[model samples]
Target: MKNLNCKNCGGPMLIDPSGTTANCPFCGSKYVLDHRDTDYYRDFYERMRGFLHLSADGQERRRRADELWDSAASEVFECSDGRQIDIRSMHTYKNRIMTAYTARQNIIFRFDIGNEDKADRYRKNVSSIDYPSADTRSLSDFFPRISGGFELADATTLLVVKKREDEYPLRLFGTLSGRHTAWLIGRMENLCCVLEYNSIVHPEFGLDTLYIDPYDHQASLYGGWWSAVPNNTAVNGRICTTRDNLTALRETAAKVLGFESASAARETEDVPKPFADFLRSTPLSNAYEDFAYWDDVLIKSYGERRFINMETDDKQIYGKGQ
Candidate 1:
């Protein structure tokens, strides 16, 4: 009620009225309420108002967001090394909701290592590897250098933008509805990297994709087609790949280059007008431009024959050397 710090990790804490518990958003820990404090409920209620924009449109958007969250699967998922992880909803906000409303469709994953004893060590790893600490291979150097505004959010959340010039930095929304959340959980195991998971479902051509560094191309420089819509598909282009994360790196790549398809692949009919308005308000840049910029930079440094993952001729063949 006092905006007190989290007892477990000392991060900011918020009160959850439904559960009668105080929660730490930074570290998914909960604590019992001190019911003796009669003012606690009133204080929390006041605090929650700021968290929720209670205007008519805000209430409607909140309702829709709650529906999206309620629909999210509650089963816990196991990571690569078998750590049990759960998907928790932290906060939601509709950028600029208009008429017909749809759930926010982007998700920015910021992973936290939960080993209490190893907290310091995890921070070290995240700062040294996830951040660009003299490591050219760090995401900061890799994504921003390559193209697009693959900017790091809080040194961990990778805000995936179509072009480096897009002024509005897109936050990853948890609106993919199902398997994507599980995919993100598995991918974050033992890895301190940010990821952007998105799905554009429209009447014409829907798209689902996520972006991260190449699995084996650890040289610090980084990184799809479209399948027909499935029968009764809520979204189009159910692209698949070798990676279990369900990310469309192998397909639907218009976000990182200056290619024509990238421009053609707009979300006009697919998403709600509010999100489209939010996107339009920003200095929209195509993902191809970002890809092309990185391509040129990598080419200049690694030479004409450098192994770029996006190129057909330069593609990595898994077990085979590039």
Candidate 2:
């Protein structure tokens, strides 16, 4: 079976004899796997067990076969220069200025006619982000990386940005547990810190513009760059600052926890008082201060940092059973 970790402490967890429960050896935290989780882990273990029995050449062939299956659902488009481009996409998002397709390794944004300037700005804003020297994290990978720009035969502009294979839109998860959303909040705070460092204000920094890899507990900002502007820029007569990013982050966490807004978030069995209070509290003056404030709240709410894995497939999340 897959190795499970404690959600309350970063300790190794041992599966109970029942095969549907696990407990931490170090912290004594216990977890009962739901039906879906149990099934997922059982199937995963069987597949991995079978894979391990195969020879090296057999494993390599399986890897290539899986890659081919992933790219099997693709569409071919003609470029202005008579070159054909194949894009493997499973989801599409449409806004006023552009339509974005979630491809296998890239997000393809096709701008509407006469929106070339907005497309250019989208690329420029992401490219201009400068991280602080103290930042040892490879933060750039979490942001957009414009890999290709093309002119299609239909007269629309196409912009492609790299995306990690594990990353998926935050919307795909629907509602999550409080502890899970807390980690997402922490990730969003980290992203806001990067934006604050670059003096960039992303107006739409919520679920629609965010992506997450649940296995790694990593969040990425991959959309809405066209609306990004310098911090303190006037937007609809209101001055925008890094605080806006933090506020949006709270709202995002609230939404993921099944709340309409941060102000409406309240303490429940799953959500602790400190976590709810953080959601409803006013953000500090800047991202740095707000992040520091969040760290304190996190400790008060959860005691210590832990890595929790919420595993499932599309069937579990959006199947007829759901």
Candidate that would win on lDDT: 2
Candidate 1 lDDT tens digits, 133-205: 3552444532322111121222222221121210111112212211121122223211212221121111111
Using alpha carbons, what is the TM-score of model 2?
Answer: 0.74
Regions of model 1 farther than 4 Å from truth: 1-57, 73-125, 129-322
Q: For candidate 2, what is the lDDT?
A: 0.76
Best by TM-score: 2
lDDT values of the candidates? 0.29, 0.76
- Provide the RMSD of all predictions against the true structure, rounded to 1 decimal: 21.5, 13.5
Kindly list the per-residue Cα lDDT of model 2 for residues 98-202, writing each as its tens digit: 877877678899998989888899978987888887553598878998898999999889999898765766754556766667778889999999999889899
What lDDT would candidate 1 get against the real structure?
A: 0.29
